[model samples]
Target: MNSEGGKVVCVTGASGYVASWIVKLLLLRGYTVRATVRNPSDTAKTEHLLALEGAKERLKVFKADLLEEFSFEQAIQGCDAVFHTASPVKFTVMDPQTELIDPAVKGTIDVLDTCRKISSVKRVILTSSMAAVLIRQPPLEPNDVVDETFFSDPSVCIESKLWYQLSKTLAENVAWQFAKDNGMDMVVINPGYIIGPLLLPTLNLSVEIIVDMVKGKNPLNCRYYRFVDVRDVALAHVKALESPSANGRYIISGQSVTINHIKETMRELFPDLCIDDMNGEGLMDGINCTMCVDKVKNLGVEFTPLKSSLRDTIISLKEKCLL
Candidate 1:
């Protein structure tokens, strides 16, 4: 084992969908990861993670809650950097502030506040969704590719039922403000629709949508989204932490494709299964996803294509008997 190489890294929401990938990558790279989950006693929730390649020696699980105060300090202890990926994601809401905004904003603040007291923490890698940036933009004329420089205007955000988008935007905004005031080194990763292998037998809500479609779950047959591999997003987090120049926000998305494309790809791969339930044109037409990825590429991070991601996910589902 490389003694000097073991830079302690803490990942919040370590058992969640995207965070799981982040934790897996950290452990694979020999980083001693302090992973936070709501209930550490629930061995069943994290057994899959504990069974990963190096979980026994390199991974440590901490009990932490987003709504609770000072619950993250012990997890942050002795860590060189923290990847704050825990925040409630909800698209529809009766009260936006309570359901979406508060937790998102408060969770970030709580983590940063804890980090403030930890002198060992030099950087924080935050997971902010592309929804945070794209939701605020007005309707794109045509093929308008947005970049890190563009931000979602809050005014436009209120009109749509994009509560989750607002949550991510508000939370990320707080993170930037807090980092500026506290002199914390922070980098934000804004990823498009995350798709990749499941670390657990049961799928998270995000992945469940795709799995549902594969299982012929959605009847509306909507198919519009540019997908990014969760693994690639995970790598971006690690790279952003390691790269000194990788500060500020970086958009990490793979090939842009419509929902029809996803259905067709899956249908082609799994013809033995039901392909009739998928509506090829149920998705909105002419949605723009020209989110410039040059910023992340500059850090030498490569993204897996959406097609390959779909294939990998299908195989994983089959292996787990979910298919």
Candidate 2:
């Protein structure tokens, strides 16, 4: 786990919004990286990774699937650590279990199982979300200070049909139990709504929300939203892997603001664009909660400002002609 030398590591879902950033940072840090993607031959999905600074000599892309048993064996075979960042993030699906829940929960198990069999693998950093820690049966009190100690209630999530939250909650829970039973060294990062520059031409859910708003569409149903920079989240994963003192889950969030606050900022930054006003009551209209990041800060993580993050997002969108 030392920060020195060119240690070999594997990153799952390497072409994703956040995972791509993780891969870039890892390569810059001089680590020999084995990146796994569903289809390595797809240039559109992998060109960004293949063009990184040290990619030609230090990066290798492997083909893997979440549901297929032992599919990650080749990618994780000789790595010193694994970063499991692959998961289904759809909001609407005909079959929640088959589309969202099964892939997330089963995907996590398959990655960990591969790591367990690899004698050279020493640690794992799993990417979870605040959705797993924020949702509850009875909504949190207005004064509640949420942290890693809080967990989303499965019964409540299922009753409300919050399949995305339920999937994250279940997947993270399963990972902890598996790690404990098998005596594995593991760390989990629960990040908020991630936003920043895009590495790929395609849009992700978070960035797509911003694009929708810029085009005069109101996509969010919640009154309060949390934000974090994708770079900060990626740095936290590397820090967690290198620091031996790190343990348990860390909540990585930069800020929590009202929907109106975000809209105002967007308006100021992009005066030329026509941004729509959100109408009707929101899902979190009156619920007030705070996410504490003291744990992540302890690992030497400094978050990017909200305004700066949003400004960079718009610029990246424009560069890709998405705005």
Candidate 3:
């Protein structure tokens, strides 16, 4: 229990890259946090949370799973806010339903059910992705900005064999519907290509873009993505929670960029590394993603610069011997 009567914040998937940072910031801000993880008994996994700044006094870890309905009840009980950052983010899916859709949708159902069961949850911040919004008829014209009003077409994504984006779309759509029916206070933070420092040695698919470039796997940037640091995404979650006027959805992405922009900058910074082709920008590919973050910006959130975010990511990978 928090002695200062600070808000009791609940963060699902506390061991994850983004959620871990959310938990850290919550504790550092004097909030008592009930962190839910799949396996609390696993010392290897829970140790990182336990080692956080105020974990011993303010942070509590509970075992919860997305598949297990009502499993989040214990952590969410009497909590003022819930940060639902738990989602299945996999690039390679052998079975889309069992691997991607089931976990993403079912877990959301489970978490929202817990929220319905608990009256103390005043605000629920959902970690949705641009994957849920980026699917569209491509031949994408520049300045066609995507914001809260746009949603990715599930049928189109499924037809195109993009299982990950489809899953995100379905999952987020279901969450919004559930919240609307339940008359719950909810806000969704949709981030794009989240990349940042690693709390664990495990590599996230989002950060792999930077990792592969640093490792000489990707010689040049062929595609561009709207990039945002994991830390900035975490802060956006907090800002959404704290702002009373915040409602509906907010896009949490930075300026559009490609890996080559990062490569050339890294090459300039660390001349020793074998990073070359500092001037090549490959076929201008993917959706000409133009995302607007005015809503989240209205909540007083400023994003980290792309170059600094990538630099920190590379340095962290090197420190962990992952590069």
Overall lDDT per candidate, in order of appearance: 0.81, 0.90, 0.83
- For residue 40, model 2's alpha carbon misses the true position, in angstroms, by 0.7
Ranking by TM-score: 2, 3, 1
Question: Which residue segments of model 2 deviate by more than 4 Å?
Answer: 278-283
Q: In model 3, which residue pairs have backbone atoms overlapping below 3 Å?
A: none
Question: For residues 83-200, could you state the per-residue lDDT of candidate 3 as single tens digits?
Answer: 9988888878899999999989999988998898888888899988888887876534677877889988898898899998998999899999999999989999888878888875
Residue pair clashes in candidate 2:
none
TM-score of each: 0.92, 0.96, 0.93
Evaluate residue 138 in candidate 1 and report its C-alpha lDDT on the 0 to 100 scale: 55
Deviation in angstroms for 322 in model 2? 1.3
Worst 10 residues of 1 by lDDT: 278-287
| Alpha carbon lDDT at 234, candidate 2 | 95
Scored by Cα lDDT, where does model 2 land? 0.90
* Error at 39, model 3, angstroms: 1.1
lDDT of 2 by residue, 1-323 (tens): 76467899999999999999999999999899999999999998799999999999999999998888899999999899999999988989899999999999999999998899999989999999988987886798868899889998989899989999999999999999999999999999999888999998889998888887676555777677777999999999999999999999999986668777888999999898788875745454534677789999999999889999999999999999888
Best by TM-score: 2
| Model 3 lDDT, full chain set | 0.83
Compared with the true structure, model 1 gives a TM-score of 0.92
